[model samples]
Target chain A: MAIKHQQPDLVPLFIRYVGAVSSKLSRIHGIAGRDLEIKLGNDGVIVQIGINAEYSHKVVPDGERWTSEWGVTYEGMRGISQPVDHPLKEPDVSGYIWPDPHKPERMAEIKQAMARYHSDYAVMVDLSCTFLEAGYAHLRGMEKFMMDLHLSRDFACQVLDGLNTYYTALGVHAIEQGIDIIRIGDDIAGQNGMLVPPKLWRELVKPRMESMIHAFRKANPNIIVKYHSCGDFSAIIPDLIDLGVDFIGTMQPCGQQVDMAAIKAKYGDKLAFLGGLDTQQLLPNGSPEEVREAVKDVLRSYAPGGGYVFMPGHYVNLDVPLENVWALLSAVHDYRRYPLNFD
Target chain B: MEISTQDGERSMAEIMKSGTLEKLAQAVLEGAAEDAKRLTEKALSESLPPNTVLVEGLSAGMTVVGGLFRRNEMFIPEVLLSARAMRFGMEVLRPLLAETGAKPVGKVILGTVAGDLHDIGKDIVHMMLEGAGFQVFNLGINVEAHKFIEAFQEHKAPVIALSALLSTTMPQQKAVIEAFEKAGLRGEVKILIGGAPVTQEYADKIGADGFAPDAASAVLKAKELLGIS
Candidate 1:
């Protein structure tokens, strides 16, 4: 209902924690994973599939190095795996073998999550690092990939085409399975602005994304398309709307995104927002009272029109204190009640 | 001998009048690597000083790029291409510059600090610094404090730039500063820190010499720190 721009009993909530933070919370609450998410108050359950699931999110001991199915080597650090070695060292993808997307094991977790949580909660199939990020952060190194985009346009197109083909097939299958939302996440922006120029993104990544979205929509017209990027991608918000993105998230409140009320007022009619809380400074360093006040501020800014979901700008990393986490939850409970009362 | 010297001076004057150096600058500004290299070769063939080609041609072009970047008229990709053009010119002039003992504008030791693996921003800073004539020893990512100290001990570069992309890894900047202080080398160098989550306030808090928000400003900050005009 909130996604459709209508008021609900309360504003929808979907808070995510990194693996380390989740373990820390689990130790205290004696619960883990989806149950802990529900206990902490999340209206949705995210089941990440594909490369992000198989590699990036998988936690290992700090400094331990391993290679993914795609042959990208990563070193585990601070609960997240950072890609250390890219498989495609050069622009040529002809010699590279893409990981099989049709493997039955890829959908195992998605199936289990659907069977368990689909009845009560909104299930989101997260296909993050989907395009540009997959190319830069995983397949090819950042510098080489960026230069390829400029100096070797055809080779860059070949790389994006490979990713589009792989993810489109996987996403279509997930849509056919009746997931409520298909989140296509790419970190194509930085804290300042879009990492790639808006024109270049439109020329290269946008059409491929449109085709992926078109395929998914064809599979299930009712499926909501959510877009996620870590930084200030406000320049492409209108483009995302044109591409049929129903929800956008992690509105990181930096650069031009500092004004949450303005953002809500501008795009509230067309797009629902999932995150606006400042996780970098406020959540990690702010007092519990400050956390609560900020939560109320976010609720007041975004929850009034019913096109908002409450979450931090990014995952609640280990840096965030346990008290801040509780304060966030408690404040959301206090202020999330609809009909808009911040007085 | 006097006649040959006079004749060489006349030809050099004619070359300058014909705007060969201006063409090299334009090539770099346009990010046309082939044109930059060809123009550089033409300047060298005409017996222009290597430093003349570097300062008036390549660095002059980069100076404009830096200004446009600061004013938001240009962005990362365009600046990167400009940097690439500058590098192609530099590649042709490097051995000659070395043989002549022509010093860089300054020396810089740079890297992403310990526990921070992100290097795209740092790499951009590296290119911009080089375009400005700094001989930079980039130590790559996840560099420990001791490694920075070791590189400083070897290179004796007067400036050190640190980058940290995550708030969690930002403390490592302070650790590097403290490491220098402990090694009694704190007074010997200026430390300029930057990255996504970095700010002037944070730099002051961490006892850094300066802070720049972006790569373009990073070049300006380094020049300011080294007292380079």
Candidate 2:
């Protein structure tokens, strides 16, 4: 309903299930990952394209850090490998191996997913770590890249150009494959504010994102664009709106004066929001009843007339008690029905 | 690290004035490290107190930077620039301050927890603490609980700061605290934790002394824990 911008029977629920929680659910239900998501009552499914696939490569020869096809290195520690070293850290960032975005077999899994659950669930392709994240975070190392943006705009633009060239074409391909939404981003902000200044973000990241979204639209024309950054990228929400971002999500509730009601009133007509539950505090510490109330409160904020999808801010990690997960979905099932009468 | 062109124009008498110090603070606030270095040298050359140059010029600028950072006026790269300026200013004053036998506000032992290689947040806090006049011993990333305790013993730091960006590695925080508890030093040093997934409520539940949501607040909490006020 919200994704289509029409009134639906109930608010939609989406979950970006990570490995541990998925494994836990899989064990409890004796089902595969996709089957478990269906059984858990998710209305949508994320089809990850580049990350952790066969060509993506998870392990390294050193057994410490794995280098991706793009030459980004990741140190294995947690649920997902965190990017540690960037291959393009030198002054001359050229001549490094860029991952082939046009891999013919890449979309095979996405096609399989579409053949399986496309009719039932809203399929969103996560092409994350897209521009700033792909460029600064994994490819160029965050600190050095951010410093270089101010110190060496030419180098910074070169990195951004490289990312834009790959992701824009890749995003267009995803849209052409009939994916419902294209999720593209990097962690451009911290808990407090923008990672760099918003000015810098607009100067560097915004244009690249605009170009990517443009390419995505040129392919599908009606495809919804969901921009994903973990922290407070709310400052760039307007820029996202201008660039035709339909859904904004996995919102980290910290340090910003996030007026949800005001956001809904202002951009609600243009943009739908997904992911509002505070996974950091409320999910990890709050009781089941608290989780239920949080769900209702979030629904009240985002699920009014329409244009809101239910999800936690980030992955439901181990810090969150299993019961709370049950409560989260249960609350979504109970109060998320249309006419949303929460007495 | 570009020095302001105006630095050469200031006379010795004017360099000793509060106006000169204010400009130095402004330079640090703007993250002008070279300008900060030149001003520190000029202030010293003008026979100003080394402590005054550090406190009034550099530290005062960092105080404003921290405040701006908290208020969301300054972001990461901006903060890094200001920190670089503060560090450059400190580089000028360290030798003189060592001769004067001036002490830091307190000592903080810091690390990213075991199995978590994330260090950007920890690095920011380390820089902020050092800028705020605290002696910090950073133990780097993927550090175990026993390693934290070992560092605490070696440094005799008043505060131990732990960070974990991953939920899988957050248990390492609890383990480190438990190790401190077993060592009978849990009460001796204040334990403060922060990261992406960490919460103040979680900190309270885990018996941590405090929780900082960001680096600026971490510095303030470190001071508050050590009774620096």
- The most accurate candidate by TM-score is 1
Fraction of the reference Cα-Cα interface contacts (below 8 Å) that each candidate reproduces:
0.35, 0.57
DockQ of 1: 0.52
Model 2 chain A poorest ten-residue lDDT run: A54-63
Candidate 1: stretches off by over 4 Å: B1-18, B71-73
TM-score of each: 0.95, 0.91
Q: What tens-digit string does per-residue lDDT give for candidate 1 at A1-343?
A: 8988898999999999988889999998999999899888999899888677777667788899999888989998767788999998777888988887888777888898899999999999999888888888888888778778889899999989988999999998888777899999788778877777889989999999999999999999989999999998999999999999999998998877889999999999999998999988898888999999999898888888798999999988888989999999999888899777766
The lDDT, on a scale of 0 to 1, for candidate 2 is 0.81
The C-alpha RMSD of each candidate to the native structure, in angstroms, is: 2.3, 4.6
The C-alpha lDDT values of all candidates are: 0.88, 0.81
Chain A only: give the TM-score of model 1. Answer: 0.98
